[model samples]
Target: MSSDKKVRQATATVTELILETFRLNGRLIEAGDELVRPLELTSARWQVLGAMDRSAVPLPVASIARNMGLSRQAVQRLAKELEKGGLVRFAKNPHHERARLVTMTEKGRAAFAAAMAKQAPWAEALAEGLSPDLLSEALAVLRALRVKLEGHDG
Candidate 1:
């Protein structure tokens, strides 16, 4: 076979894999929605909370959006809703006058902990047959793709 033929085959396989990843993302989001339902949280809210929970210090809406691969406007909307729910509070940002830092309240932390507890079992069950090394490799590949995509606008 020709080298050009091999390149085209590889490109086709990568395209198929990307599409499969999107399908899996939809399923994962659905499962996530179910997992956090008991905590009165949707997958979007849970993700925002999770990001704040992971951060050592408070972050602005833009930072949260960047971390979550979401738009700043979308994160701002979630932050506003979370704030109204008393799950998060905004603080003055020393660096920026208008951009406030978002912090999870104790209530938010408790909810996140509860959701994490439930996620532990679900994740373990899902990983029942998967190899740790394989999972790590897959994560690395996905991260690499995300980095490349982030650098491209279209």
Candidate 2:
């Protein structure tokens, strides 16, 4: 093959990694859906809850979406749904009048705790044979890629 028509080896490897990441994302979502189903939450909803749960303070939909690498509109919709379900409530944001903060209700906290309880054993099983160092390296690589991509999203 001509050099002009050939892909760089590193580029090809990155492309493969991207494809695998896509597949992994789908499978993870499916597994998350199954894991949280009995709690009346889908993967997306659980993810939103997780974002809120991880934050030290309540966040607006836009912040939650940004934190989760999701679209603000999608997070806004989910926030509304969660509000209606009594899982979360919108509180007045002192910083922004229009962007109300999303706070998890008691029910939301309970559901999130339950979901995490389920995840602990599942994650342990999946990591049974994996080295912690390997996992840390993988996480670092993914974070670096994410930072690079985010920088290019202007």
Query: Which candidate leads the pack in TM-score?
Result: 1
Q: 3-92, model 2: which lDDT tens digit per residue?
A: 854768767878998999999999999999999999999999999999999999999999999999999999999999999999999999
Residue 57 accuracy (lDDT) in model 2: 96
Q: How big is the positional error of residue 78 in model 1, measured in Å on the Cα after superposition?
A: 0.8
Q: Candidate 1 at residue 151, lDDT?
A: 92
Tens digits of per-residue lDDT, candidate 1, 1-154, equal: 8999999998898899899999998999999999999889988999999999888989999999999999999999999999998999999999999999999999999988999999999999999999999999999888878988899534
Minimum summed lDDT over a 10-residue window in model 1 is located at 145-154
Candidate 1 is scored at a TM of 0.93
Angstrom error of the Cα, residue 39, model 1: value is: 0.5
The residue pairs in collision within model 2 are none
* Candidate 2's TM-score: 0.92
